[model samples]
Target: MLHLRVIAPAELRNPILNVLQREPGVTHIVLHPNAAVEPAGDEITADIAREAANDVVERLKSLDVQNLGAITLEVLDTVLSSAAYHAEDAADGDAADAVVWDELVARTRDESQLNVTFLLFLCIACLLAAVGVLTDSPVTVVGAMVVGPEFGPLAALAVALVRRRMSLARRASAALLIGFPVAMAVTAGATLGFEALGWVELTSTRELHGVDFIFQVGPFSFVVALLAGAAGMLSLVSAKSAALVGVFISVTTVPAAGFAVVAATMGDWDIAAQSVAQLAVNLVGITIAGVLVLAVYRRLQTAKESGGRRSAGV
Candidate 1:
């Protein structure tokens, strides 16, 4: 369930109420007239079923509540009311399967920010992967995979493509296009710095067994990336954060980038090239799979809403 709060000007309050009252998935409606001092509008609040949240939010947006006033949706961790239960029961679908698109777009938009912290995380993750590559440590490589922040932009890119939001698409694209190269360059510099300091030594013919797979590209690499992408998006939409850890572990994007830089530093151009290929394969696979998943979900949602409207003679 979701707790929805709205502030609307006097003139539009009635229409907003009409919309909420008409929704069977809403309950515990409370109207505090002229309750907003700064905005000088009525404050309306209600409990809404998660399955019906998107439709209600869109309706409210059409009334210009977001600009003229405000609309806030928060997930309800605990709802003990019978009315809330009834509202959930009245909704069209299961809460677990619900996709609140506004929430998704907002989340991915924030996650795709190109800021100092993002760069730091990326550089650190790549460095860890590089260390893992040098020492042939699978555990370190897995840790690096979990630390990488690339998935956020990748997921945002997929969402932007499906929603046709060019602004968002460009932002997400910039993050990935700029972030990866910058991280790789930093990793190479760091590796060189370490060698200069006599902290570590890397040779072209070094026998690396445990972490060699990071540079080996094959059909299964793409397949695993595809699966990880789908799972990542699902976890985002379904609020299954635990599942995301597995998604992160399954993809070799960060590991490949790390290995590429380390291999190049060692003058192993052949291995570096292979690592680059692996990185490309994983990124493309995840993106393609994410786009397909969101596209299919959007289609199904449109069909379901259209059917509902037709049945209601709307």
Candidate 2:
């Protein structure tokens, strides 16, 4: 279930209240007249079934409620009311399968920004992965993967494409296009520093057995990327953070970028090229899978809503 808090202008209060009252998936409605100070309107709150959230939010948005006043939606972790149960039962589909697109857009928009925090995390993850590459430690590589923030922009790009949000697409694109190169450049400098410090010789033909997979681009690499991408998108839609962490650890994007920069800095052109290829494959696979998954979810949602309307003879 979701909790909706709305500040409605005086002129639209009745309409908004009526919309909520008429919806079978809404309950616990409260109206506080003249409660809003800044917006100077009524404060209305309601608990709504997750399955009906998109429809309810869309109707509210169509009334320009968000522009005129404000609308806030929050997930309800626990709703013990019998009315809440009835509301959920009245909805057309399972709550877990519902996709609240407005929420998603808001989330991805925030995550996709090319801010300092994003760059810092990416650079740190790449540097850690570089360390992993030098030591041939899969554990360190996995840790680096878990630390990488690249997935947000990638997922944001996928969402933007599916939703046709051009501005979002551009932001996400800028994050990836700029973030990776910047992170690689930083890690490459760190690699050179390590070489100077006699930490590890990058020029030697030392075979990295455990971490060599970071550069071995093959069918399995693409396949793993596709699976990870699908899982990542699923985790996002479902709000499963644990699953998202697993998705993070399942791909080699960060490690490949790290290794590519290190190899290039050391003048290992052949290994650098292979690492670059692996990075490209992973990025492409994850993006393709994410786009497909989101598209299918949108299609399924439309079909479900349409079927519900038909069943109600609307």
Candidate 3:
């Protein structure tokens, strides 16, 4: 299903070719010898000739070819048999690489930066939720839920815990810890500013009791968080990323945090405490669920690998 292109030194070419040939999903191997000048002895290139791109990548990693010079295995969806022979041909690079775990981590780290877009998105979401709470509009609340960008780092945290990558875990945790506080502070400032401009009257609403929606944690709150976390993780690993937006909408984190800020601004300490409790409950529940789901996914992958090895008598 995959097309492998190997450009190695005259001596190492045979060994590398033998490895590729033995790989289960790899076929249509093309060898390029005496290709170019380089510091390393050999240059290896591969493309995904099979639909089992993940399997092929894992097999390549098992060969431990990093010490070799500039080994590039570009996983291609379409077969380019003749193109492998044409070393100088230009092609679109995006289609050449498959989505691997490390690449996913790198992409997530890049996307989760505390940039202006992230701040704006969180701020706007919280503001909308505050307005929703004031007007008692469930539609606006759902809008706020969809606008929150809290899932990026949470998903990253889950992946880190599954892989036992402590650095990633710490980074993700720091992002969450800092991001929430920052979002809340901004929301509070905005609330105060609105009050000064006479744009928001906190006392005029009869539905101050409706603020209980933001606070008032219960077993169902934890259940929702747990399910959201599992769905978020699944959305990350599966190709169904569109479903993640819906997952974001289904949770109340942004709305709760925003409501808590509004409660604090109105000098409602009791509601503020309740909102904080709600936030804590959701966060803990999601983290626990995400970790559990990732652990199971990793276990299943490991079991599959072990079974394959046993079948091959390795």
lDDT of 1 by residue, 1-314 (tens): 99999998989988999999999999999999999987889999999999999999999999999999999999999999999999999999888888899989999999998888889999999999998887789999999999999989999999999989888889888888889899999999998998899988878525988988888898999999999999999989998999999999998999999999998888889988999999999888988888988988888888889999899999
Question: Model 3, residue 259: what's the lDDT?
Answer: 84
Clash number by candidate, in order: 0, 0, 8
Model 3's lDDT to the true fold? 0.68
The best candidate by TM-score is 2
Q: What would you estimate as the lDDT of candidate 1?
A: 0.91
Candidate 2 on 196-266: residue-level lDDT in tens? 99998876324678888888888999999999999999899999999999988999999999998878877
Relative to the true structure, candidate 3 reaches a TM of 0.78
Give the candidate order by descending TM-score: 2, 1, 3
Cα-based lDDT for every prediction: 0.91, 0.92, 0.68
Q: TM-score for all predictions?
A: 0.97, 0.98, 0.78
Better of 1 and 3 by TM-score: 1
Q: Which residue segments of model 3 deviate by more than 4 Å?
A: 1-16, 27-55, 62-100, 204-206, 209-211
Query: Candidate 3's residue-wise lDDT over 19-68, tens digit each?
Result: 66565444455555566576434445555432345554555555554444
lDDT of 2 at 295: 93
Off by over 4 Å in 1: none
